[model samples]
Target: MISLIKLSEEAFTLYRDQILAIEKASFPSPWGARAFLEEARNPVSYLWALRKGEHILGYICFWMFAGEVHLLNIAIHPQHRRQGLGTALLKKMKSFALSQAIEKIYLEVRPSNVAARRFYTKAGFQERGRRKRYYTDTGEDAIVMSLELLDRSESCAERCGAAGVTFSTSEAQKDLEVSKKRIDLPF
Candidate 1:
């Protein structure tokens, strides 16, 4: 069985090798241990892993602040691609954002990465803009994409009422849900 779990500094340390293996395999300019280590230490940054027992098949790293999410990195092991894992991870993040009343999510993909762009488009993220020379490795331009999670035109009361809960921004900091069957745990 697979589950999603929040990664802590210790978790990152423990899974460094496995995560790094996927990282290096999935990207052209992969992040090294130092980058994950830094995210583990950063207060606003969050890392979530898709785990099957002790092995991490995939993971996502992002930053949340000011009612917005900036997805920094996401990757799945080569063997695990095309199995809906990427979409699952993205959906998990979207749900988390909605739970926190986050308004939008922003991410960047290399213009040359058609697969990623297609995936994001299928997931409801629209092309918003472009950044010049966003990829330092190959000087490739990056296409910015964004997903609007909330209808800000509506009041909090209306939105929260529809969900049968009072609007409370404090819940944004509430822990991720957990269940033994398939839980999202925070360490």
Candidate 2:
């Protein structure tokens, strides 16, 4: 019963508390409501919330730039983890990226977050590289991942690999209006 919807300033106040609650519940060092508010007002940013009826269960944020989208944050409430909410949110993100004409999508996840890594792996994202001491609070390394634009119209799992890599197949592949691109950011 999870649905994805664009988040805007008008609906910011309504979901602020819920978003914060999920952030705190999911992350060791959580972002506050004010931080989320600031990002919502950023022109380069887009936010989406996973909601069940009136309750927000999780959220994703990204920055769009020059035909690419960089995932900023994605968090699901601890109580609702492993219910496919994250996957649904990522699918929505890919749809949005394709719609925006983005050919590359990227994200950074803590190296220790095996579940998230596996989730992304199954969603056609591949590990490309690593950033040393990327998490300032914990001094933890981050694994960079990206998804390449495919000619296929469906989601597909990517082969395991390192970063700064590219995969392309040009055999009469149909262009899809998806909103996700595999991406990586150097830390």
Candidate 3:
């Protein structure tokens, strides 16, 4: 069974090495262990890991500030890709943003990452703009994509409540209703 857990200090301490291994395998330019530790310590940052029992499948890290949410990084284990885990993580982030009254969610992707671009487009993100030589390693430009979280008539909270959407925090694990047979895990 897969579960989603917020990255707390104790959780990070226990899974630091595994998380770093996933990061190294999933990204061409991966964040180092120190970077991950620093991010975990940042007050404005939120990180969550998708796990099956004690084994982590993936993680999403984001920064929340001033009614905006920025997706800093997300990666699935190489062996677990193409199984809809990324989409699940994105939906979880969106739900969290809506619950927190965030206005929009945005992220930067490498222009050459066609698969990621397609995925973001399908997820309702539009290309807002670009940054010149944003990546230091290869001097690659970044494509900025953004998705608005609210509509004119109703707030996301209302919509979510009406839809009977349920999400639990790190402190409340028992509140989540999970299924072992399903390939995708809930947020």
Candidate 4:
């Protein structure tokens, strides 16, 4: 059974190795055990894991504060790339953000990571800015991408083509049916 669930202490304990492996494989310089542990303890940080039965497949972590979400990390296992898992995880993230009154979601990626940059753009994220030498590992410039989850004047449908998806900062859409082609939302 494939499922997406919050990474509880029990799950983290059981799958720490796998999760860490995914991170290491997905990035040039990955977070170590301490970083994951710190995030788990942070009140504003949320980490979610996607699993297939007992095997961990991927995860997403983010910080939510002040009407914004800063996506700290997200990665799908190498073997699972291009299977729509990334899109599903992103949809879940967007839904959760909208419910929490978050107005925007932001993330930074290496400018050289064209694949990730493309994915974010397809998911409705726009290049907001660039940071000089954000990645300490290789001194690579990071491109900031942002997604507006809600607007005061327009519906999400108008901006991203979710059709009936509409919400304000105060009210969140309870249900968002994410369709691959039907929904214009990038991920």
Can you give the lDDT of residue 43 in candidate 1?
91
Residue-by-residue lDDT tens digits, candidate 4, 65-175: 988999999999999888877776777678767767788999999988999999999988999999999998899999999999765454544333222222111111233
Please rank every candidate by lDDT, starting with the best: 3, 1, 4, 2
Error of 1 at 31 (Å): 0.5
Q: How close to the true structure is residue 72 of candidate 2, measured as C-alpha lDDT?
A: 83
- C-alpha positional error of residue 119 in candidate 4 after TM-score superposition, expressed in Å: 0.6
TM-score of each: 0.80, 0.77, 0.81, 0.79
- What lDDT does the true structure give each of the candidates? 0.76, 0.71, 0.77, 0.74
Estimate the TM-score for candidate 1. Answer: 0.80
TM-score of model number 2: 0.77
Ranking by TM-score: 3, 1, 4, 2
Candidate 1, pairs of clashing residues: none
Tens-place lDDT per residue, model 2, 112-158, is 88888898899789999999999999999999999986544554331
lDDT of 3 by residue, 33-68 (tens): 778778778999998888776787889999999999
Worst 10 residues of 4 by lDDT: 164-173
lDDT of 1 at 168: 14
Query: Of the candidates numbered 1 and 2, which has the greater lDDT value?
Result: 1
Error of 1 at 11 (Å): 0.6
